[model samples]
Target: MTTEQSWWRRNRWPVLALAVLLPGTVILTTSSEWFDYQNGLYSHAVTVPDGQSAVYGGAEFRVDDTVLVRGGTEGGDELELDPDMDLIVAVLEVTPGKDLVDSCNLTISATSPAHPEKRTWNANVDLPRKFPPTGDSQTTCSDSQGEPYRLVVAATVPSGAAETSSWVQIEKIGLTPNYLELELSPSAVSSASTSSDISSSSTSAVRRDDLRQKSNATASRLTRTGSTIRSITNPIG
Candidate 1:
């Protein structure tokens, strides 16, 4: 037999198997990449208006109350806030459809009445030292007590956040690509019109300071020549 013919006869099955499997492996990898790309492109926010409820992740959630608590030094766990930062608390009434409660993350999106720009603040997971307590309520969705319960979430925001219209957003864990935003209505805990008005200058200063501090601590530290050598935190959201 010829040398080429002899080699082909000995390895024909293995060569054919590789030819078939290589394309399938490429397709499998590309299919997952396509799915992730579509999810990133199509993810959107569904706004649940005030006094309304939205069902997500087998749970019905309604924004019961949204309070902008100002001038207090309430802390949670090991986290302490700047005196210029106020607390924006949202109380949600969540009813789980099944026995298992869904886990969710909370965020506060506030738009300044004066500036018309949106700012987002993530909920602090720490239990506050002294907060406007909701009796027997759970701080997270996973800590449900087998029935409808209030879930409290708080974010430390700039001092004059009371002047901004805010919404509480709930992103269900394991069920992604979209999130629910609950509109905050006018609360009985009156807005601090005076504090917000007078503290606007100080609030701007505080925001600049916060940005400077976070840039120094969380953002990548650069060399003297201004090239980043190591990143301290993930910049992607």
Candidate 2:
């Protein structure tokens, strides 16, 4: 080959490499990302119901409780939340305390989007009159969709109890949400490979030859994300 031809041959790959790399670097750096992580919600002032057979050791009320329900399920057929991933986290919280004085059972759970069922977790008051009521509880759950949750803390007390009393005041509490994340598959969102999962040199050059199209596809994904959020807020049949 002539000297000019030899020079071009030696520099050709490097020149093409720069061409491929510069734009890719720009695209990747500007590319938006969505990652999954954990989040929590806290409860408002919580109160048990009144007039059951198991009041308190003496008083007919419960102490204010601050509950932190993190993302999931401790057991059983978990509530199918994520129709896509079907992911769920069991949640439970309680400050240490002694057993109740009267033997009464309770159920707590969120009653609405703004209200969670508190009756899902409960215990008997106490027996033979113990001092300072105490009980611990937990549950498997998904976060609310950002709203108020009226926690129904219903106590089921045995009727005609000789000594122990039932019935306490009920209270509505706080609610929270978990970070719901989503990623589309090839079929769900067909486009150029955004990134090679592998960094090996072997497949590095296999990026889509159509740069303009890849860019358009990337931006369209954000729209898809918005659509997903809307669906989650109001799902279709």
Candidate 3:
């Protein structure tokens, strides 16, 4: 009857088709996420205790220990942190699964009630040896005799950042995601505090020298073993 009515009449079929398709498209696009959630894939965080191993995506990961250092060396080079920053290093033991992990990624953050600002940093991963070891030592990822590799991940953050928070979060890289919220045990916290106190006291110079020597020795060993050290970008919060 009118121009508006004429236009609607002409577009009616297309409008109906869109209405019918939109809901179906949404359902189709969201089905996989819903299915994964229902199957427990998107559920609870897997909390692996310190010094224990957890398997994810067929790979075995173990958090062996953690240390607080002023800074450290990697690949025969000194890696010094900023004056206000402290380095937290973790020792990880990894055994590859089906895939040969070329690199590992992680994030470390410090929370403090007084500060209220989060201090977070990405880890710089250092592998102990060349992967897929050459010669007779070579073994498949699944082999029982597979040689486990050690990795040192260092995170540099504000000096007192970790003292306020008891948990440090770690996320493994890749599609099949894995998370580790490592508990900063009392002993670990105490150790960090003790180190901090030593740095602030008159004996700081001596402590720093000692740490430098230790770091150099560590770097020498890693350099000789053909270890690989790579720094990864920080994760988007």
TM-score, every prediction: 0.56, 0.17, 0.48
Cα lDDT tens digits for candidate 1, 118-236: 78787854323543334455667863555887676677777666465778887765555667777775431233333443223222212332322222332212101122222112111
CA-lDDT, candidates in order? 0.55, 0.23, 0.46
Please report the candidate that would top TM-score against the real structure: 1
Error of 1 at 17 (Å): 38
User: How far does residue 218 in candidate 3 sit from its true spot (Å)?
Assistant: 13
- Please write out the lDDT profile of model 3 over residues 78-194, one tens digit for every residue: 233455556555545566565444543465666766666765576553322211122231112222444566554446666567766534454444433335554433344445455
List ranges where model 3 is wrong by over 4 Å.
1-44, 70-79, 115-119, 125-146, 165-177, 181-186, 197-237
Q: What 10-residue stretch in candidate 3 is worst by lDDT?
A: 130-139
- Over 1-237, each residue of candidate 2 has an lDDT whose tens digit, in order, gives 655567768899998999999999887866543111111332222222221111222212222111111112111112211212111111111121132222222332222223232222232222112111122221211123222111112121221110121122222121112211111122111111121221111111112332223323443321122222211121100
Full ranking by lDDT: 1, 3, 2
Clashing pairs in 1: none
User: Best to worst by TM-score, what's the order?
Assistant: 1, 3, 2
Instruction: List the candidate 2 regions with Cα displacement exceeding 4 Å.
Output: 1-57, 72-101, 114-237
**C-alpha lDDT of residue 107 in model 1:** 81
Candidate 3's TM-score reads 0.48
Question: Candidate 2: lDDT over CA atoms?
Answer: 0.23
